[model samples]
Target: MTLRKRLFWLFAPLLVLALLFAYGLSQSLILSRFDRQDAQLLEGEAVRLQNLLEQNLRRNLDLVQSYAQWDTSYEFMHGQHPDYLRRNADPEALSEMNFDFMVFLDLQGRVHAEQWLPPTLTDMFVLDGQPPRSLEALRRAILEQARGLIQTSDEDLYGALIAVQGVPLNLAMGSIQDNQSTLPSAGTLIAGHFLDGERSENLQQQINGTLRLLAADHSVERWAPLPSPGVFSLNRAELSQRHLPNEEQQQILLRFSNSLGQPQMLFELTRDRRLYHEGRKAIAIFLAQATGVSLLALLLIYLGLEFAILRRVSRMHQDIAAIGPDSSQQRLQDRGTDELGRLACEVNRMLERLEQSETRDREILDAIQDGYFEIAPDGQVQAVNRALCNLLDYPAEAMLGQSYERLLSREDAERARQDFALALANNEQIRFSAPLRRGDGSLGHYETRFSLIRDSQGHFAGFRGILRDISEQVAYQNQLLDLAYRDSLTGLGNRKAFSEQLRHALDKAQREQGRLALLYLDLDRFKEVNDRYGHDVGDALLQDIAERLRRTVRQPDRVYRLGGDEFTLVLPDSNSVAAQKLAERLLAELQNAAQIGALSIDFVTPSIGIALYPDHAQNPEALIKAADSAMYEAKRERNRVDLFHPRLLSSSTQSG
Candidate 1:
């Protein structure tokens, strides 16, 4: 064979192999992108479905609370009104309100009225072999369950997913309180939503996906375990050609547990993999066409090749290599309408595009608030953007060529070096936060994301990173957390913080067999102080009292402001004697005149009440209620310390 023929045959086979490899690589890339997109879509849809279910439950609770607060419903619960069920609990009205079951119970646990959406399901109840003769019995059962729930929780309104007769229902119960006065609940209203096939269909329509109501069978092992109560969990089938017969198609499963932490439902989603198959088919076709075109092009090039053409191509390659970032005006010499000429022109165009893209990238980096930087594999700074210079309080010229340690403390610099080594060794990205030392000697908090740079041969070349100053963001978050737990006026723990402390203290006392006491204090004539003096003086006095309480209490014994002039002290490992002594000391200190600026105020005596854990009450709410009763008793006698006693509850109620 001639020389040209030998060259054509040699290059043709290599081109075909390259085309096949490209086809396989393209298929892998396309499949990866599709997998990620499908997973994200599945997770988003799962969240939407969970939100829908939660919204339905919230809507039912709001409806129940609204009706319970109405004058007619309150009166009906208080009194057995004539035709109350017929007027208000009508089936049509219940259906329109989207309530599956609603029951009103008096304080004595007598069911006044009850209604069900699907009237037939009421009689076909599967909870018992024989359905109740009257709907009143079922209503009473629901009310009893609600009462049990309320006794365990502090909220006047609470909800849970309850199973009755192998059916799931979103149930919420609320106190039927007089709108004008909420104290002394007149009755309670129980509301529910039966998760039947129709409701599932409605949810499917809203989400545009199939909704399967899996049986809450804990025995049936799931691929993806149920999430924590009220949280949604998502899982997708592992992408593999060796899938099972039923799992040939891509599938996603979403599972969420009810408030009771039992498996509520599993939603199986079948994703359309048609695009993936089509993409592979298209790549195969392109590879076949490319292979054939490569042979023809090689044959044509072999025929056209001459010593002069080879020399011109060599010259063009040299010209291309000579062009650099500073040589923007350089262009390839276009000799004629030929392949080499067109190739040379394309190279020039590519260079122009690269220059424009580099300018655009620099502009983008400068516009960002975060610092952008790159470092060589040896840990030397290669490039620094304008934002990075501003972040480190250094000029770009001074920053470039310096070690990364320039912007970090010695300890942090060592940490960064270790992290960089790890990223390079493992060929992975790393993220960390550290204190950054600026050029001005001041330190600021920064978070950095470092990605390893690799060459075409997959060897570690350098590191590129983004650094963001998060000092303000972190400070603001801390401020928000403090505000949530601390009282604004007294800087003491607020009601929510106090509740958490009390619960923890009670648990500790019970677990360790130790004593715990809760002291409830009501400043005598505090309202008078506010009325006689302005609220400013009253607030100052409260602050002073809070300081005194904190000073009097021993370490680990916290004081909390429970709104208004009410305060609570959680003292772990304390008995009646110690608690009484501390209460007396608190009263004595509070009675001492409080100095608010130039003003001095005396005659502030507190009616203190003490309740011991495991003696007065077991839980926080009961303990607080016991202490409140004793506090009321002390208030009547004026500035006395009263320990919680069973008789105090009735006596204080009678007096009030």
Candidate 2:
């Protein structure tokens, strides 16, 4: 029936609820962080496995190139020697090479000599028409799929995953030639390995993950069905989601589409689920801590109400008439050694211990790296830690009675006040990202975690919060964003970035009822220079073009190199005249000779096409298509700029 007991009964459940809510919020945030880590990790694993596959193919192609350049092989293919197979493809040599199959083909696509590791297992390859067992089926598939290898350059190597049998085959092919004999050519040399071999086992061990290429489309049968597509229970509909959800197994699926836009293969990875498990374990530990801390806080609140507020106020006037406002270190002098005097002595000792505990708690709060503060419901600062004082570069005396607006802009402070009021009404958690005004007048980003305070009457009294400086985290995210949107070759915005920018610009134009201009540009004769001078020169030329674009466009304009010799520019709030004039000036500047390491290349020129929103098309994709069609029209004339017309799309469609 005492005042202290009444206060404790009223607020204990609310304290526990606050702790429970905090746990839930923390669990959500931690899981999301883990999910992001898993996604990043899966992406990294995909790249590694992809590179591993390429390396295998490249290694095989290197051997093929070596065999093709052999003068003896060239002579044999040309009918100058008959004992070539006996000398070169002996069992010992085949065992040392350790490849699944090797085949030699003449210039006329006729198989000359073929050797396979397991010569007895001839049923490994299967084609559409041929019987289930025929190496000839494979040869025909190669001829049909990679006939371009017939004219492959001396340095060029062709590598790809081919569905020959029931699994993806890593195949490498190259043209047969003699670098020493100056012979016109021999034919083509091909070498490859099936994924069911020892090589695949070694690959699995390297990444500590299972890798499988899943055959997806069954409606339209493949010409080369994977002979052993493995025991996958997931159907085409399930595979469309990309991954099968599993807790113990973290799976990532990357689907490979064929030329007809049908899913052909699914690149699946089942790696260690350590990160996910670690996240769950962490949440469990946090739950235990939350429960323990909540109980401890409940006890403290009850004792403080009894000792400091209710009992102290009731007994203070009678027992401590001599005590001063700053006389905290002073104690009441009890007169006798009776039971009442003994109880007074015990109470004094308890007060001293409580003082020490309060000091320790304040020290811990001040030691925290994140800023912490408490405010009245009216938004006045009531209490703060040393870290918060340093964070805002304000003295404690200066900030203790001030409004939160001192640390936040008027708009931000108002929003925060609204958020607090909403959370109080709904009895929910509060957290938000906001920019805080710092001492030097620059704004710093912070994530504020908020909790409400209540008086003895259990009414709205104040608020408490922790402000975590997230400037570094924000900068790191920005850096990642830059990497994602930027082209590595020319340092211009890439296709992904262009797509987003175009969409955003279109949205803005529609909202404002203004016009947006999109320019699609292709460099004329860029492939000629790239073929003659190589990629280094091509890269220099692209960078030069990107620089020219940066210099020509206004600061508000967005420029991007879509891919290869293709470039795009998004101009919001641009009129038709401004867009046309910009394109013309860009074309004139591009015509100027580009200097690639002292090589004066005057042949390079740009073919630019302009498309305007509300004038040409409705959406980003359609606008790009229209601009691309107009670009082709300019390319036909060479070194020219063209405007998008509805007929341009029709003409292109008809030509196709």
Q: What are the models' TM-scores?
A: 0.38, 0.45
Residue-level lDDT of model 2, residues 1-656, one tens digit each, is: 76666787788778777877877776678777876677667766766765566566667767777888887778778787787767887666766766667788887867888776643334343222233345555456655555543453333345556565444566677667776747676777777666554655688777757775566543432222221121111112112222436776666655543323445455677766677679888887877887788788878877777775566545643555655434676675663475656767887787788778878888999999888999887778988999987887778888888888777777888888789888898877799787888777788888988887888898888788898889889989878987999998877888898888888889988998989988889999999988999988998989988998899988523898888999988988887899889999998889999988889999999999988888889998888888888899999998999998898789779988
Q: Estimate the overall C-alpha local distance difference test score of candidate 2.
A: 0.73
Question: What are the per-residue Cα lDDT tens digits for candidate 1 across 423-478?
Answer: 87887889978887788989888898999888899877899999998989878987
lDDT of residue 590 for candidate 1: 84
Candidate 2 versus truth, CA RMSD in Å, comes to 47.1
Assess each prediction's global lDDT (C-alpha) against the native: 0.74, 0.73
* Model 2 regions lying over 4 Å from their true place: 1-357, 367-369, 378-380, 389-399, 406-418, 435-444
TM-score between candidate 2 and the true structure: 0.45
Model 1: residues with Cα > 4 Å off, grouped in runs: 1-9, 107-110, 119-152, 218-249, 274-292, 298-656
